[model samples]
Target: MKSLLRLTLSVLIISLVACSILQREGRYFSHPSTISKVDAIGSIPVRISLEQNWTDQTRMDFWFTSQGSRIIPYSWFMWLEQADSRALFRDAGHMEQLRYLPVASSAVNPAGLPIGFALDTDTQTGDAWLGLTCAACHTNQLDYQGTKILIEGAPTLANFVLFYQRLVNALTVTGKDDAKFERFAKRVLASDYSAESAAELRNSVLQISLAVAQRQLVNALPATYPADFTSYARLDAFGNIQNAASAFALHDLTNRNPPTAPVSYPFLWGTHQSDVVQWNASAPNTPIVGPLVRNIGEVVGVFGDLSITEAPWWQRVLGKKNSYSSTVKMLGLGHLEAWVKDLRSPQWPQQYLPGIDATKAAQGSVIYQQQCASCHQVITRSDEGQDYIAVKTPLIEVGTDPAMAWNAAHHKANTLILEGTKKDIIVGDKFSVQAPAIELAVNGVVGLVLKNPGEALKAGLIPEEHGKRSLLADELSSIEDYLQVNLAAREKLTVATKAASLLSESELHGLVYKARPLNGIWATAPYLHNGSVPNLWELLQLPEERIAEFWVGSREFDPVRVGYRVDQGLSKFRVRDDGGEVTPGNSNLGHRYGTELSDQQKWSLIEYMKTL
Candidate 1:
């Protein structure tokens, strides 16, 4: 009986492993090796003709600069593998297979890590770590007749959820398999390889793996609803950031909420001057504190280390206030913001794609003035000091997906241990047990800024107009003003939740999705705030006439439609919009503004938009 049981257990383990592999195989579609190579012979460098202050070197810096986010230890990421195979996980070929843009090995990126993957080192400990930079989600590439055209600041088709899941699986396998652990240890500690060192490394891997698994559990979308799953080009950034700040940082697991509202990554070209950022327009772009605070929250969400601990007895006795400690690189964030100011929107590559018909474009210009100009205002891409504010179209008016905007406005969390903590460590009131997730995030940012005031100042946290700045006085005032603006915006959103009868037109506008300038709208497609409508042609159709379901994760351009070719390519992730409860976050409804136009007029408008 004992011999039979041992054989049965062995068979069961093998069966389970086989099933896991099959599941992953079904979910992820690997691209062919040929697809990774750019056919440079016929390719044209696609970019706007407008001259900017920054050079290509500056662009590369923006692509690779680290923001102190440590997704995993540097050695582990360098030598990790897939859960089921000996193949390296971060291999350039494997990353390309997953749709991550490949970068050649260089001094700046000696490992030849994919674009946006960077090395971050601890200033005090001299320990190196591996993490993602902004380019991971923002850089894009399109295939036009086998020639690849790189578009900076455009949304990438990389599968973020799959990438993270694979990493977690790799860590788990390395911890369990003795052979894998031995190999990983040897590579990580080549000079000091020993049983003792291997054991230590294994423990560290297991602990980190366990922590990552817990986070995935807390943030995972409902399995019952397929629409909530984040595929290529979309992420519920707000939800994830909230969970990171209020749940993980505070060590309150119950405070977690599933990240269900996935939206396309917005292009960064004109974001520097926009009055507000984000799909829901939740973040106000105040001068000094605005962009810095927003970037800090993003880094924290993306594996940046943040610890909220009780103040030491000596400090409490000495009247030194408590503040959250974080690994966010403040100066690095400032540099990124400055670089973004110089980014120009990409124009139509007439050489590769079909040229715009001048006559149709002229006709479309008239239609644009009548239909689109009110919301998506025309802008001069070359203007340095252009003041462009995104028009906040109310949910009831534009009627796209409401999940993202709704959650941002109303998601509340239990403050737990943070109940009585100062709302702002430098100066402000205390928090209550029940607070909005945005409030908690703001408090976390404020605490981190106060904890490192010198770095914050050097990072340009104060406006230059506030000359001869006192760290405590000017910085605190600016932060407070910024905080008030955020809080006031949140308040409007909260109150707007009341019955329509009780709401004024202005109050109703609080629940909105911002209509941004469409300078590069042709390049950033899968239209609407939710990214449900696949292409411009379908976007101009009535809600019911639009494609009910389509595949995403393709880089092949559909020049005629001005979006990616949705019929097929690398990934098989289906984006559905059946207009039912099952597809809450993926609804391709509303935005009925120009659906009544003639087909010829619609085509004309699309032609004109390519010129923008």
Candidate 2:
């Protein structure tokens, strides 16, 4: 009887663990929606046709869908069954916050994938792998009653923290399952393997999965990061990149700082034309080099082939190194950048929303020019018939929350290692390129190397290009050999050199934010650098009157408020006064422009802004 009970208990434990592995929910199925085809309805003038727009969307779809060799082989996520992956997706609770859209067809993506995910073939291994793209965080949808508004430039609402947590949980659960081991091994390593090889591969995958899960656990401990380190829609964009790049290059996880410097994702619309981009106005915004470096940085952040590990070098030398593959598709990235330049600001749907009062808008336009034009107006220049926006990188002190600026000012690149030596470069950490000309030189030369490895080999660029690979200028030479090879690249390099000539070396470290042209300002809300304010109306109020605490992450449009509706209870952010100074990154203080204006004046200003 005792032996029978013991057997029964063992059977129950197996069933429970099996159920945990098998249970899948929240699987997304693609369904066609008319949201993409909706008319601009007297918004901004579109340069491209709706069909062409759809084609651009298609290009965007491909860009977002194609896996760029980010993340690791045999991730716990790769082992998850379709149902289980879906369950993890659903459990993340991002349906409303991130405003995920349904896809049009199963033919486009198998497993009924959501907007952000698509199966990509590993270039070397010829195996299918899942990776993330720009759409996961960049694409946004707003529900205006029954109408769905698709805005591409606004910050994402997805809860990445939760998604990461679910992934860790999946890894933890999978690690404890002996029965699931064979299936995971076949899927990740090899289907037809000798018993010995399979055992080794299974153990390798387990080791990787377990290590990742352990890291996730360690990161979740409150002591790992700041107590106030909570990322909702906004992420510590620069800090995460720094940490990831450091981790990838060094393979030393202990030194990586937690991505605690959270800031709102700046909208991309009209950014290509800016003088200097990034929230902190750190990078040079030259047409050729700016976009190239920016995209490279982005791809690296998103897990593209930016790994400088020995494995990538080995793969580059040989065809494949074990299961790892690294390919930097520079031309493809150039195409993506060129495509993004065509993206126009979203037009305010005057027909769908309440039509703007034109007369009042005119009056507000007068007020805008009087009170706001000095800072917000676009500066243009024409030299010998060539016209361009004069990059006016003015650091205005409008008394908005200075935390982002402070954080930017204080941050340093302490962990970066110098190439060909154990010496680490003691450089100021920033989101922008520190030396624009140097960056262009490096990118132009290195980009060519990555583009044509055979030519690079023939040209004897192996040592210089591959010997000490990094994002710095030490390994890159200013000599004619690499730079003079490509005329177009050289010309662009010259152009970048001239564009950054006016910038002083000290200016590169300036923590000032760029005042972007307010073309579609009404569409992007939760104003201020940190996205602390919830609406334009609130933004116009005095610093004291602005709600000290509020929540973010809702797509329900409050057209009158000129921002997404925020419910204090349901919102993702809750700024509290802990009696001590508000956390540096979380403060809702400053940027009190136009606070002295009357209610009617503020509304009129908002109305005028919608037309721009």
Which candidate tops TM-score?
A: 1
Candidate 1 TM-score, true structure as reference: 0.85
Worst 10 residues of 2 by lDDT: 26-35
| Model 1 agreement with the true structure over 1-612: per-residue lDDT tens digits | 546534543443343344334323321111111112221111123333223345879877987899878776665676787788887777766786667877665656656677788777666545566788888888888887877777788887777887888888888999999999888888777666788867866766766676666666667786665632687778888888888877767766556677888888888888877878888777777566667887898898887756676778898797654547777898888888777766778888788788999999999999999999999998876663364778988887887878887777667788775777666544456778777786787778877876766677567543333233334334455445555554555445445443432444334345778888898788887788778888899999998788867778788899899899988865443445344443768788899978999999999999999988
Backbone clashes per model, in order? 0, 8
What residue runs in model 1 are displaced by over 4 Å at the alpha carbon? 1-53, 318-321, 422-429, 461-509, 571-582
Tens-place lDDT digits, model 2, residues 261-345: 5677676556655556567555554433445555555655555533333336665486422121234344455554444444556
Question: What is candidate 2's local distance difference test score?
Answer: 0.50
> What TM-score would every model get versus the actual structure?
0.85, 0.69
Q: What is the lDDT of residue 355 in candidate 2?
A: 84
Name the regions of candidate 2 deviating beyond 4 angstroms. 1-69, 72-99, 104-108, 177-205, 211-229, 309-328, 378-396, 407-409, 413-509, 568-570
